[model samples]
Target: MQLIEQNYARMRETATRDLTAAYLDRAMAELRGELTPRKPEEKALTWYDPDQTVGFWARRMSLEAVAHRVDAELAAGEPVMPIPADLAVDGIDEILVTFLAFASRQWPEDFGDGLAGADGRAVSISVGTDRRLVRPAASGVEVSRDDSTAEASISGAPQDVLLWLWGRGDGAGLTFDGDPELVKRLRYLLKEATQ
Candidate 1:
């Protein structure tokens, strides 16, 4: 758990730092007339205000990058790198617990209730410590957990699973079993993130 947490933290920090530097470079270019700033009325805008802090964006980007890195490593058929269990727990807590909790709360009330009968469905996540429970939302999508005792299991190298959770489709190297519908729904959630 500790190793997962440490790696996650390191990945997050590295991603944030790299992205910040890139943003800074672009902003500097705009200031020097090498690039043009978007008009205030532009319908599409990418850059944030230079004076405004972008911690939220940084965190999101960090997680996305780290998740993909895990995927890439796994796809290469390399040995699964172990992360601190605590860090893995923290990543799950932030992305699944905290972030997804907010998403569930903020989701439009009219949004069609997720998969039918998904509420009582059991899921187990075993990236580090084991977690087991019914799907959090009516939405069918969910993270994978330990299958040794789970009714339906989704197992893979941590990185592949993380990438799949984050919605990366290139998970040919990963393994999954049972509840194909649930897996599809989970994949959909990841796809939504890309949009």
Candidate 2:
């Protein structure tokens, strides 16, 4: 806990209002430098990046920055702005694709038990007009853009869906279709994977 406290303190100290622009510029430069050496077709190993590619990291980081900006604003008691629908869609995709996949790999035992009830069952997720169908795979989950008749479906606006998927929202505004018990089970699995 001491190490965590020290790191938290260090972050607090460095979190200055005046240096925000400079910090962002420097961070972008570093990220660009890291991406510059990669071939167009190459897939890089990334812990939290989506799709194992530089492009995915760039997109994911952009969304992350916007989310963190909301967090900072909320901390300062300012009104929050909505994230763009497209960006929120991408954020949801990153969680479903990159984050969950990495989590399953890191903690296989947790997922094996967590996802068992929902295994081989397809769950369709809809955010506005965007949609994805996902089913359990041996490794984690597999996603496809095409719609299918799923065992359960969750539908909501992009922002609400993104917030719900990230555990920031309670899914109160989302609609659940098909079997209620199956939806509950899938929600549990998603929460466990994210945690």
* Candidate of highest TM-score: 2
lDDT of each: 0.46, 0.67
Global Cα RMSD, each model: 10.3, 7.4
TM-score, every prediction: 0.48, 0.68
Residue 191 error, candidate 2, Å:
3.0
Pairs of residues at least 3 apart in sequence or in different chains that clash in candidate 2: none
Off by over 4 Å in 2: 1-45, 48-52, 74-77, 101-107, 110-112, 137-139
User: lDDT: which candidate is best?
Assistant: 2
Q: What shift in Å separates residue 2 of candidate 1 from its native position after superposition?
A: 16
Report the lDDT tens digits of candidate 2 across residue range 66-87: 5566565557666546777767
**What TM-score does model 1 achieve against the real structure?**
0.48
**Residue 127 miss distance in model 1 (angstroms):** 1.7
